[model samples]
Target: MVSDFRRKKLLHMYKFLDKDGSGTIDKKDFQLAAESMTKQRGWKEGDALYKESLDMTDLVWNALQKAGDANNDGEVSADEWVTMWDTISKSAADREWLSQYCKFIFKMQDFNNDGFIDSDDYVAARSIAGTSKEDAVAAFQKLAQGKSKISLTDFQKLWDEYFLSEDPNAPGNFIAGKSSFD
Candidate 1:
């Protein structure tokens, strides 16, 4: 059984990730998410960020679809999400896979290939995830912890906190760019 807290988080995540509002997460949802991030960041057709976003989208879709698809269906329903979440939580976290995905996420948000994410880049990425620039700025201020830039390691740590930490005030809590986890 999924823990109450984890279950809640998963549902909250699913709600945001269900890009089509279809009550399920599918390939189109991931694709749209990538497209939105790229578009929000003004990544043009030939831009590397645009291509990277698309690649990241495919990776996420491939991983989740394989694990979360039940009954051979392409969509991941609430029940399936629960099952998949529990499974992932039980298994040891794969550092290699996590590292790759984290790299992709940080790269897409880097904007300038500067090896760090600044306020502008952070806001751009969050905007695609449903946050306003103002909100993202506020969150990033706290998340940055007096730093002007966020390294890939910082972003990855935040990513882990978002998934694994129970602390309400965790700096990484806003990894999804949402102040409200509801």
Candidate 2:
């Protein structure tokens, strides 16, 4: 039931993510990608193959493997990579779980449920989400869409999409939880 447009987009993104062209990504792939991204952003100098800390590389490798390897093959087929990214991209528009997650975020953000997420409200949620102040503010700004406040409907839409996709009962949420946190 996947549409042509969405399918094409996913395929495109997969190519962009597969920097190594090895037909399969490993920890080295993520490290290279991260280093490239950092250098592209002008965070470092020179064209040398910058190395990420072992711990950081391990985390990225594990995340990509879990999210993109759909066939339990320990590697990502192009189709699997495309599907995984497409699902994440599509989640923004999903309405069910987004609504619930938004409510939770709002209630958590609003502190007293005063129908608004003020600076203080945002601070609390940021702390809870373990995001830095700048990141938290940026995330809110993006989610709020330049609005001064987020409506329940908006929150719900975002929440449902973000959370329901991970729900065990969700149709495409059948990802094998390889890790306990998964």
Q: Which candidate tops lDDT?
A: 1
Model 2 residue runs over 4 Å out of place are: 42-58, 85-182
The TM-scores, one per candidate, come to: 0.82, 0.39
lDDT by residue (tens digit), candidate 1, 15-60: 8889889999999998888878777778888997688779878887
User: Against the correct fold, how does model 1 do in TM-score?
Assistant: 0.82
Cα lDDT for residue 113, candidate 1: 80
Question: Looking at candidate 1, what is the lDDT of residue 48?
Answer: 75
Candidate 2, residue 56: CA error in Å?
5.8
lDDT of each: 0.79, 0.51
Model 2: ten consecutive residues of lowest lDDT: 173-182
